[model samples]
Target chain A: MKILKQLKMTCKDTSPLISESMDGHISFGKRLRLKIHLTICKACQCYKNQLEIIKNLAKKIGSEDFSSKKNQTLRPEVKEKIKQSLNNI
Target chain B: MNDRQLDSSMWVDRYGDIMYRYTLLRVKNVDFAEEIVQNTFLAAIQAQANYAGRSAEKSWLFGILKHKIMDHFRSQKRFQSFNQSDSDDSSVDDYDDSGHWKIFPKDWGLDPEKAAENTELAHRLEECMSGLSEKFRQIFIMKEMDGIDSTQICNEFDIKPTNLWVILHRARNQLKLCLEAHWFQNKTSE
Candidate 1:
């Protein structure tokens, strides 16, 4: 019975779909499994859509370099120091 | 100097700043982030023999920096469970699980593009981040901002793959809800 519940859960959980949808790292098996789940479940579909949006928003944040100002300010001394340290070692 | 040390030094010179920036995004403290970057380079120097040259050196350093970030978080006692009142069922229940999805206009209701365009969204994200529980914040920043792979994150955090997924889901959900409540609700009211 516990195995049956586990099987049911393996059947019920839409994590594979959500994970693939978010990360774009879907495996062939996970893709087929997701198709099977989405064929029957509507909630997972909406969840997947929201997940995509969240993922895209995150991508936008990554594209924008919030650290550019700091990057530009790497003092020549620091660069020289790093170079010297690497040279000495 | 040994060839390994020479090659590692060259790699660090090329990629250290990028790694430092990645760590900074996750750790949110310059000094700590720099320390992690230093450790990542030091570890790379030590482990250069093990590097099979499978991935780009940048990716390899990133992999190490990621571990260092997680170590910093763990040492700071920031590794905590994501406790929420909403059960998993309730959290995901709002949407249909089927593949059919509607891509409605994502107003997020905040017009994050406008916020981002205004140059305040960065700080807004930072402020909103400060409100999160430390674990959620770290996980979100690492996965979302640093573009670290989930499997690598799981290995670093010493968490099961399942636990990593749940933490990521809850963190994203919490961040979305926080942004909506703090920044978007007023837009809707208008």
Candidate 2:
């Protein structure tokens, strides 16, 4: 019973670390514990998978995409405003 | 034609739109973004003599824009207030006392290829990002979109590395939840 309780606590504690681990390094013990918990916990497994997808998608949809020349352009008037500001400087 | 005057006039045509878009994503306000970009160029003009061509011209302008962005948030006190209110609400609700998810993660129910290819998904993401609180939005974009390093983010925000991780963790959680509800789940239903 105590082992089962500890396992549950391990699963809970390691979930956010799963997300954080993607950005940087995690300790070997924690990584081992996370792996153990993931084997037993389907929900956390799903969470880790989804977090990976989110992270990948975010990397793909970078600031360049939002600022892509074909996607969004400054209004001509705004451009004019900037040009005027520049000339006045 | 002095270097400063020539550079100032040419920058409007060359770097203006790109800087505007970059600032717009961070600031999430068109007018404010425009103003910041304008100031960035003006500051560049004033400091053009100091720009020794060590970096690319575009990078130099971006550096100035970044400082202007920080100034905008700091002067408005947006980050301080929003961090207090939003962090309080999110940090408590997402995880239970035992650090387990109160709500289990939901399957997105879409093929990864299809989801990534969809232009509409990208549009929805920008909308969802805009919905984030100012500080979270700024940090998430700086880290994920702009690809800025964590250490740089910490120095810029005057936060410790641990605080940076906590903010990033919360930001990712909020973004995941937001995209699931508005994009993935909604699209699956439709």
Return the top candidate by DockQ.
2
DockQ of the candidate models in sequence: 0.16, 0.43
Per-residue lDDT over B118-172 for candidate 2, one digit per residue giving the tens place of the 0 to 100 score: 5666666777777776777777877877678888877767777767777777777
TM-score of each: 0.53, 0.76
- Model 1 TM-score relative to the real fold: 0.53
Q: Summarize candidate 1's per-residue lDDT along B144-171 as a digit string, tens digits.
A: 8768788876766667666766677766
lDDT per model vs. reference? 0.59, 0.71
> Candidate 2, after superposition: displacement of residue B42 in Å?
1.6
Question: Worst ten-residue run, lDDT, model 2 chain A?
Answer: A63-72
Candidate 2 residue spans exceeding 4 A from truth: A1-11, A68-72, B1-8, B52-56, B77-103, B109-118, B155-161
Winning model by lDDT: 2
Clashes of each: 12, 0
Model 1, stretches more than 4 Å misplaced? Answer: A1-50, A59-81, B1-13, B46-57, B77-127, B142-166, B181-190
